[model samples]
Target chain A: MTSNAAGAGTISYEQAGVNYDLIDPLKVAAQRAAAATAGHLAGHGFTEVKASRGESAYVVDVGPFYLASIVECLGSKALVADEMGKLTGRSYYAGIAQDTIAMAVNDLITVGATPLVVQAYWAAGGSDWFGDAQRAQALVEGWKKACDTCGVAWGGGETPALAGIVEGGRIDLAASCTGIIQPKERLSVGDRLGAGDAIVLLASSGIHANGLSLARKLVERLPQGYMTPLADGSLYGEALLAPTVLYSPVTEALERAGVRPHYCANVTGHGWRKLLRHPAQLTYRIDALPRVPEVLRFIQQHAQQDDREAYSTLNMGAGFALFVDAADGQKCVDVARGLGIEAVVAGRVEAGPKQLLIEPLGIRFGDDDLQLR
Target chain B: MTSNAAGAGTISYEQAGVNYDLIDPLKVAAQRAAAATAGHLAGHGFTEVKASRGESAYVVDVGPFYLASIVECLGSKALVADEMGKLTGRSYYAGIAQDTIAMAVNDLITVGATPLVVQAYWAAGGSDWFGDAQRAQALVEGWKKACDTCGVAWGGGETPALAGIVEGGRIDLAASCTGIIQPKERLSVGDRLGAGDAIVLLASSGIHANGLSLARKLVERLPQGYMTPLADGSLYGEALLAPTVLYSPVTEALERAGVRPHYCANVTGHGWRKLLRHPAQLTYRIDALPRVPEVLRFIQQHAQQDDREAYSTLNMGAGFALFVDAADGQKCVDVARGLGIEAVVAGRVEAGPKQLLIEPLGIRFGDDDLQLR
Candidate 1:
């Protein structure tokens, strides 16, 4: 099956995504807009070009002194939570909080920042979470417990009641995490990654949180318990709902060992667009990956999606990727192992123009998002 | 007219009046949520609670040291702008800058802060507003012009784009304004006004930017070209859209006139909630007030709302309320006249709990919001 045909086949919001043509012009517009006001637009180190008219988004120069990160993911997992509620499942919101923190904490680690405060916003149609104070308090406490486990402070969040916007008692949970970084540098694929650097794969706890929107659509069509082809087949729901693992400690150990990873990118969705945003003249070749769980295989086959599509559509087994010096690679892996997470030699960078070459599998993500633009 | 309706009788998010029971518990829950995180909250000093959990919409505060205050408002006006587009009118987002700035600036004046920056987020469905680039640029420009007129600085903002949850095609505009305030000794309705303190009234510019969700609904029921109707059949959309006058210079004058003026509050609605919040025990009696403008009269009639409901719903013609010594009452009038806005003595304090007593008009508002328990 063609990649686009399997994923993003149906036109949706990105079809309504910001007009890329207006991207450059809006930068120019924002410059003019900022000039007519008080302080000059704060300069952010990440911005490559500052333009003139309208804008897509304003990236605040939060200044590197200390960085606070706020991130949350949206997926059909909330729908699963609804199902669990009907079937009398217990973990409920606690299960969702694990994934929320998993996503937020990972963002902080990727940015070399540690989590500070986590504030969540839960929007549901007409759920009286307040009436059952125990349930409401428990939901928040569960989120706090997850944060405490990750060694981060827990803040608070808003539980908004939107009468019509939400559906089926379905709720969307989001978190804003504040992070701090006495950051020595920023991480992107473009620079540090040179040819021959070793790549390391960090084991993911189940899915490690992402692609719920894609996963939900696939699971809907699959016959229940298709993986075992037996009893009550809610395995897809349980697997897809598995909480993501927090990896702050894993990345922290690598940093403490003075093993600077040449390039690190959170690997999710077997697709290559995000990785492609890295260095323009280096090739990222990943040879080894942790065991692929059968849950993904069952869902992928049932959805009629191919291997390449499933990879980019799910995190597979590896949630994070790291590139290190070939000479110090074992030390880095040892440090990662010390943190209680499996770290294995994945592959090496090669001389090429920003490409991901999957050798053993004879697969190449080369067309739209794979090649360097 | 019920005493607690948040908007005019115009159709609103709640076709029937607000469900205070639902709203009340939400506020208590919000307070719990806010307080849990507030101890860890940094950056600003919490100001007066504007509309509390059981009472109103926002709880506004003033910033210290940074001296800048942020004014945040629910952009109900954006709904009207959207409806304008849905109907024959397209440039409906017009004149919203004043409302954006007005909502914030009004809050700033309460704490003796002068606005410096006005940033807005407009979520335009498929497009970019609730705040994308183009609207941010324009809103900033509009705020700049309005703030420049009031001698306040126009700083920048943060705009975003969201695809789901919010209505797809409508743009939702919300603002966060930052203004500079010097050390003003605790300005909470302090223990100053006791018996016989005169209440003075200042005029509101049109709707003064709140409750447009209902106003738009009422406006839609009218025929085309009805938006700009004026005496002699002249179109006056510009008049209705006029920005609320920035009262920074006048507030500064009132402070300098040795007129610690007991207490003061900006009047967005006819109800004097802020005045009641001041630390004083007196019955505020209104003796004389300027003629109510026709636009308010229309909203009052069109929505089929009477005096008290309409009073708390729309600002009517009075936008600012100040309590002063009867001795300097005329001087207060002279100052507002100097600022080119008409003002007069509306009422006075008496020997009792804070009550809004309309003497000439023969009405008494036993407002629960004025006294913070």
Candidate 2:
């Protein structure tokens, strides 16, 4: 299981060919351009909630309600699933579907909106790719299961076969969801995220759909490939492919229990660095951290990535974070526990520069690491 | 312009490498699978308006409002623009962005929902594709223009760089939109379609966003590549790259004029055959077909496609259709005209088997041709 050398040299996410430096500028430009069209919402008797523009989802002010919409792709993780399927002959589409839905719904719930409908966009290089009944059935069943888990309807979608634009036999899975936050008070745009608020870290299942490009690159160096077993005797690929945790249930439970989180962040591409994603300038002091998942540890060791690179690029076991009043911190944790989610008050918000501090690892991430806003 | 021999051989869309026969069944299966999750809407205090599924968009019943959502891809049409850009040194991404938005908003209005927000999903095979500042800026500017034209807010979207799943330097563009049908009476799910309903056909800018795979295949055989001149003295690629007509304005005008369409269909993939997309058993008899745009004529002649194959695959000049009361047909056309859309009363609905008959072309499409339901 440990045949491959852990580290001969240093490696980074950008070294594996995925660079946030090039992508972030385009995102910022796109946000500015999209802001120009927000005035159109008034034509339909709705108002544009400008605060939600750069957030995970776009929130619109409809009469008596606010609607949140988000469009997200599962990224190159589907390709990893395809590769793993070829090696083991086991259908990995179910997990891919779950990851795709999770990417969208998790972002939707960041604003405290309950997802209503999820529409899919499955663009394949060829139509024959779906001929594999087992894979196709797994994808459909998994999508339904994810939608059911999030309490959202599986709306109709488009399955386009782009022969030349997409690589043959590969499917690019993405989904867009529409959610609602009724009574308006449930809307959590981080406006109330104040100092002394508790930061509860929700446990992630595994990789959870981010940093797959780097993970796939790491597999090329693995002598055993997907068959490589972790310390727990589980296949590396299987562990990484574990379906992402659906945090919608936890958010719903928190709302039901009257524990309103001032802000929520889905720990994804930016890893634990997402802890300081709130627009306000506040230091996130993390005194504790969740146990690192085995799959992520394997990735860290194989890729020779240091703690900074690993925590900035991968989820590192923490899937989500919730900021709530100090008095309601334990209540939020209890609500998540009631929903079978392992969570704890891992940190707290403090008046300072926007930065994250990991007390155990002695690591810190400045606001510059998360350029989402 | 007339150098290529016309009708030298019988050409079908399937021969060009796209077969709806195999694609339709999967669509049917997907629709069935998605239906199972509709019950989840109840958790959000909304209901799945069952009638909206399988239509151009999925409509959900929210309190005091019905929301219509659709996720559509631009298909390989952007590749056409990419090819054209390589040849002409012109940035065609502006038109490509418009086409992507048109594909979503056109379907959105089919159910009488005024688009409130449109979110984009741009999956590129490489991150450096956006480094071409000219091309990227054109895309941003054009996307904003389309949103402005449709009077919808441009909600932010995901720009994923999928290194392996998509072709390098190429992007697969798609978008999802959420719309509102207020006063509920404006909802048009074909329930009002009757024998005497008149069908109005709106003029297409060119090929729109469908049949690009076949079109790209035809380009391989072009004698002059993108520089080939058509009878009208316009380059073939430039003609095909014409921005899709934004029909949201027309729908808005019609609704403002109190002319609610019995049903509406975006003339895209499956071409004019989309006229019979309604689940009801009725014959759409076209007494007057819109003049085939020069671009379609060029493609049909060069590809050796007959009227049947041409109209069944490409838009062939008809971009959108509105089924309305016989007396209100002229009013609808006038409304479209006021919005600068060339429209005419082209047909009428008759009680019979679900099919479309183009009287002038002597072409008929049976129910089997469109298996959307």
Give the number of the best model, judged by lDDT. Answer: 2
Q: Candidate 1: which stretches are off by over 4 Å?
A: A1-39, A42-80, A83-210, A225-234, A243-272, A278-281, A290-295, A318-352, A358-373, B1-17, B37-77, B89-209, B216-295, B316-367, B370-373
- Report the C-alpha lDDT of model 1 over A1-373, residue by residue, as the tens digit: 2234235343221232433343334434544555555332221122211211121111222333333333344334555655655555444666776676666566545545545455455654444434545445555656766666555544333454433333424455555454444353533223566888887877776655555545555544444521333123545666666667667777666666776666566654333334444534677787776666556665556555566666655666777777778986788678878877777787887887666666666556643554212
lDDT of predicted model 1: 0.53
Residue range A101-208, candidate 2, lDDT tens digits: 999999999998988999999998887877778888888888888888888888889888888888999999999999888769989989989999999999999999
TM-score, cand. 1 vs. native: 0.64
Cα lDDT, model 1, residue B99: 71
Interface-residue RMSD per candidate?
7.2, 1.2
lDDT of 1 by residue, B1-373 (tens): 2323434444433553223344345445544544444332232123333322122122233233223333244345554544444544444343677676666566656655444444443433334442344444555456556655555433333333334434455444444443333444424233565687777887766666654545655654556534557553533343445566666557767766666556667775334455565544567777786667676666667678666666666666778777778887888888888888888887777887667766665656775644333
Task: In candidate 2, list every pair of residues with a backbone clash.
Answer: none
Q: Could you tell me which 10 consecutive residues in candidate 2 chain B have the lowest summed lDDT?
A: B1-10
Alpha-carbon runs more than 4 Å astray in model 2 = A1-7, B1-8
In model 2 chain A, where is the ten-residue run with the lowest total lDDT?
A1-10
At residue B239, give the lDDT of candidate 1: 40
Best-fitting candidate, measured by TM-score? 2
